[model samples]
Target: MRPYWCVAVAAGVLLVSACGAAGSGAAGSGGPVKLAFVYATSSQNPFQEMAFGAKAAAADIGGVDLALSAPTGINGPQEVTQFLSTIHNSKDGVALETLTPDLFVRPLNQAADLNVPVVAVDTAPPAGTKVGLFIGNSNTELGKALGEEFVKQVPADATGEVVLGNDIPGLGLLQQRLDGMRSVIKAKRPGLTISGPFDSGSEPTSNFNNWNDIVKAHANAIAYLGVGAQDAVSLALIQKNTGRKFLAGSCDPDTSALQAVKDGYVFALASPEHWLKGYVALRLLAERAKSGKALPTGWWNTGSLVVNSANIDQIIARQHDEGSRKAAFKAETDRQLANPSGYLRPLAEAN
Candidate 1:
């Protein structure tokens, strides 16, 4: 029916198609497994970085199509809504940052009923959610680390003020961090006077204003625990207003915050290995999906590292030259993965 040349070309195309289908069949011997990563908000750089890392890691693994999405805002209810939508849309597996576990538990269970592996990253879901795994640092341990670093920097005899700037008042993770720091401070240094566990509010501008007012009122304060990006803005404001420096610590890192660490404006930053968190979450989901096994229960604390002035220069240089904070993240990830049992423990167990 066709010319000789055309017939030969058609035969070749058919052969190639057959071989490709066979290869795909061998690769996905179990079933089709899709992965979706949903974040609290696309606007925050931290969540965006996590999404990027997850997508990149998924690319490394065969038979994975990573769909990274996020809500428009940081509201917990909105996060829950986005997560539920993602679960409904996902055909295979899903990974999400758990801002409000209570809100998402029932929906997550419904996904689990459909045999979709669900992993929580960045924040732990509510207890008894049957979540596959939690891949992030112990928030309380991070808080304690910040407190210890602050105490180390402040003068022992100085009975100065210390303030903790918390962005989310009701969040369990934030409360755990504050408690961890407060407990350590109470145990180690009874002389240090702690001030208002001031609510920094969610918005950056609100945090900036709150910190500005706090710094003005308590000029003698020696330390602050900033829980979010506004921490950097607060540090900048402090430098502008007081003309004096105090030990500044934060739960996470930002470009400006890292720069502050380099400039000696920030005393310490507890940088979590979020890249590894994303990678592990995806890898675990992929493995579980392939094996037809239920996802592992309990939390997997990925871990965090404290970066200070002594090592800030190297961190900054790595950030500037190599890539988007991947080097530091890789180092931390390697360390934790190498000794998972040693470092990856619950907050209560960490102490």
Candidate 2:
């Protein structure tokens, strides 16, 4: 989350390679379909996984040109600027993760004015925008799941405290998780106190400092809910530093975070099947562009999967052997698209 040069370096290399490899695949019939992708944290594992998945999906289709980019940290204005720049330079379609919905509308509208389709992946933009599709899990649902999981782990008759760490409160997706967890915990466990939906910043070091403060103040806190990798890493680091283990869980799957879970430092992690999301986004865009039809306007909610010790082996194996995380995403996308009524739903109706 820190302003690291690594992501820019990797992105530059990938961009060059992608541009160079352009002639190998068949370009779309009307013209080359240029798709731009923007994410939250370029260095974090989940964002990297999502990018890999997007690349794989683009490769599988073999007709579209996909360009992926992300800013170094959680600066909303900076990300919005990137989105606008992509829109200005884009020739076909655009897909982005909007950290702040309000900040995204203008650029999204600009894309719409140019007759370019826009899609939201990983996070949704503000309502009533011209966004054609959304391909990510409901953050609120993940949050409720987190609260329910925590309730199951805590002693029923005793009062306990759970800390929800927010890496960036401005991101609407993270807020949904916080809200969902609050709703479920308040309903099911009245005695449970949820404290400090604190802004941990987007950097890992900032998150560590914020978490250290929480742990110092509330030594008896039973669990930690992290909305992003920074919070997840903070919990892991805190356990290592204090030699005290708390029930720590997170909302996304990053290689480092998953490794922590495998090592027993993390209790659970939940994330939308991102590989599938990427694939679906690409497929849907292709369908719309090919058919010369405008995509639906409302949000599309792609549900998530809960990963624990039981299924960690399968996930790790899939990541290692089959393809990049993106390949797995393509397969999952195929499965879900096969039964749209069963697996896909409108965001308004999904919640």
* Residue 122 displacement (Å), model 2: 2.4
Clashes in each model (backbone N, CA, C under 3 Å)?
0, 3
TM-score, candidate 2, is 0.85
Give all candidates' CA lDDT scores.
0.66, 0.69
Q: For residues 309-331, could you state the per-residue lDDT of candidate 2 as single tens digits?
A: 88887777766733646555555
Please write out the lDDT profile of model 1 over residues 1-351, one tens digit for every residue.
211111112211110011112112113464345567877776655675676566545543444545666665576677666666667656567888856667787887877787667888887766556774677777788778887887787566767778887877888777878888888887777888888788886566777788888777777777777766567657766785768877778755567788887777887887764666787777666555555545555567777778888788776665563245555466665665455566444533322
Q: In model 2, where is the ten-residue run with the lowest total lDDT?
A: 1-10
For candidate 2, list the clashing residue pairs, or say none. 53-326, 275-329, 276-329
